[model samples]
Target: MDYGPVIDFHVHLPYRYKDPIAAADYLVKKLDEANVERAVVIAIEGGVESFKKRVNPKYVRNAVQEILDYVAHSPIRSIRTLIFEPDKGIDEHVQLLIEHRRRTEEVVKAVEKYPGRLYPVGSYNPDYGVDKVIERMRVYRDKLLGVKIYPTLHCISPSSSKLYKLYRFVEGINGLVIVHTGCDPGLWELPKMCRYARPKFVAEAAKKFPDIPFIIAHMGSYSAIMPGIYFREALQAYNVDNVWMDTSAVDPLFVERAVEEVGYDKILFGSDFPYLVGFTIEDSIRDILKLDISSDAKRAILHDNAERLLRMLGRL
Candidate 1:
């Protein structure tokens, strides 16, 4: 029951609030409610805007999802339904990037409001154009703890050449990188895209950016349709140093296995808050607290590891 010095490392700005100030306010309120001391908020453009259009009844989106979530965790939990969306045209991709750029700006603004309590991380994608990526991200060049890249949502390889320049930019800024690794539900579930989220691809990047820490978000174990589907890949990636893994939406069972095998030095605690629907930051925190691992590991995952990384980067 004792989770020492908690730091939720993987939260996103509240989609419900378009305003950065309101989003940060809601974030702090939720953090306080969950008893989390600090949180790292990634400004990734989420699927709420796009997914709502696909919902049969837009108003019932959350209501229906809450029920589906209940079912996903029950006795017959293994059953999952996938929503495979086809290729998005160039225009749509540009729009998504534009929105993402806007969110990055908001995150910079939000972090300015709470320096120590809230850490800022921005997002980038190829469609945003290599030039635009750096331009938009420069808004936080000196302020960011790191950048969060989504391979599945953006449909690019973890080690794509398009991202090399971005990596170099992050390196220049002395910031870390967190890459999306695992299957996301809704429009992002296309098998082609899911394949890109595998952590094996990120190993290539880790090798390329030996000086920069690369945290594989979800540790390649995040699958809304198949929980822990890529856990082996995550375990494999954990072997190399300077490449960390986060337990954002990963099952505790996998975390238990990870600790038993790899130890906890490079693991981080992240709550894919607000985006995971039907789940809360407190629930995400409890996932680690409920782990059977020793208190030392729990402290390391919940706080120490992230604290060390942030302090090492001079973000905390």
Candidate 2:
């Protein structure tokens, strides 16, 4: 019943802030210590402000590229994504960014460089008209494998009117969608302005778009902030299919609740990684392993679910 390779599906590689390799290596060591076989790493910084204020989005590109290179030469399998920040990488005011062609080109090169090891996870601001965003997505549908959304920061609901068409487009597509759910340590000011960042909104989205595969990171935003809200979202996930939760941050209680309400089938392993505090990827997995869920469920959550998801996205 032992899942040979523990796959942490939700991990962040240091893209804009400090040293990416240092962050990657730190997680690598933790993964090695935990005997995790593979880890999926994502980059932060969607725009110029994130680049100018906090971290550089280019670092995101480099992080993915370098992580892929390391995976190619090393024994570990590192899954990487091409980040698309609608505000910075794309047009801030428009639903679709103007530099999509250039962005798509970079994504194609990155994927080609790593072959099966690298994949592009397109990001869109749902606050913009969903139709326009979907139109943009249709252009790269052939090349992209997944989609990412940040409803919280964008101050829009997952089911926002602006994103209805986008949601439909995403549901119709074959790739997976990873949503940002959790308290952002860097954006403390956001809480006052955005309330839809709550997991309930995500849960409702899951209910509305039952077919669109969704991975709610940060245990519905528990480990990071709004501890109570995380539990509610986890509880709500149980009502819908095609919606799963991840151990994106350090929320052991939320993990335990996810096991209880959604069953292990609905949980996927994750670690926010470089953005995390004192904990490492190993710590996150260890917290989940301590749950009372069965070994089969654990195996599925830790690796199998992610493996199947990756294959579905053509990354495998």
Candidate 3:
């Protein structure tokens, strides 16, 4: 498609690349392959420890039941354990620590190595102590453009008080927030959790902190069971001046609707790297190019919008 000047707004470190240096190198290679000029790599820290307050007993029980419910409700062919490995970024205890440490190092190294071609974004769960999240954030403030938060995975609402301080922190630092909208896969796929990922949740935060920019990642994209139920919900965020949406792991059909509803200026291109199926970074770029919108709109989504954000964040 030759869609150049791209800025992938959502991505995460893969578990396979144990070494941060190797991971950074590999990412650059893939970016080059897809001709992506830059990427915002999300540092996803997943483990029982990552659970708010170190896994409350009630949370564990609910998680287990949710998994069971998911299994019982889904078509066997779709979610069979052998094929349904939805824990994309979660790691075991030690691995989580190592991966986080490596992820930070990787982002730093990637930026130094590629020079303005990669941006880092830290992840936060409000359930985790706000101070602890802040402590982790301070280390990356100099290097990070913003924070990516998971309401669906952590089973908390975006409007929860726990996230406000973090929002304030990001605002104080002049950083953006990437709110995961839509359904999560695997054990984390409870309707309750996914419900909070809709753009409505982000609107609450935006209303409270109008200065902080919130990008709705996935635009309330849903899993098969729900099927675009929240996508429309996400589009409603267009009313909130500080809110925007990213097209990561999102369908082209929804992207079209997003342009019509939210306008292309608020849409950002995102690959959600290491995406399932054969969805490569190139494919993600192609999806935008294939949208039934103007070339200027595609350009805005692919590069111009993200460039504006990076400039605002002082990353460019």
The lDDT of model 1 is 0.75
Query: What is candidate 1's lDDT per residue for 1-316, written digit by digit as tens?
Result: 6555589889988767778899889989999989889998887754333333432332233323444554344343112222111223223433544554436777889878887898888877444656787888886688888788787666567688888898999998889989888877543433444678888888888988898899989877776556776789888987777889999878789889999999999999999887778999988888788889998898899989999998888775
TM-score of candidate 3 to 2 decimals? 0.84
| RMSD over all Cα atoms, model 3 | 4.2
What lDDT tens digits, residue by residue, belong to model 2 across residues 94-175? 2222222123234433334334433456666433345655676787776566566665445566756666566767656666
Which candidate would rank higher by TM-score, 1 or 2?
A: 1
Off by over 4 Å in 3: 50-73, 76-106, 125-128
Q: What is the lDDT of residue 289 in candidate 3?
A: 92
Q: Per-model C-alpha lDDT, please? A: 0.75, 0.57, 0.73
Total backbone collisions, model 1: 0
- lDDT tens digits by residue: candidate 3, 1-316: 4556688888765557866667778877888898788888887644344553443435444544655655565664324431233332232323434444433445555566666777777777443567887887787677777787777655567778888888898887898888888876643455644666778988898889888889988888857666676887787876889899888888899999878876888889888887545778888888889888999999999989989988977777
Model 2: clashing residue pairs? 16-56, 47-88, 91-97, 182-221
Q: Whose lDDT is greatest here?
A: 1
Instruction: Mark the regions of model 1 whose C-alpha exceeds 4 Å error after superposition.
Output: 46-102
TM-score of each: 0.82, 0.67, 0.84
**Backbone clash numbers for all candidates listed:** 0, 4, 1
Clashing pairs in 1: none
Candidate 2 Cα outliers beyond 4 Å, as residue runs? 1-3, 16-112, 126-139, 223-225, 311-316
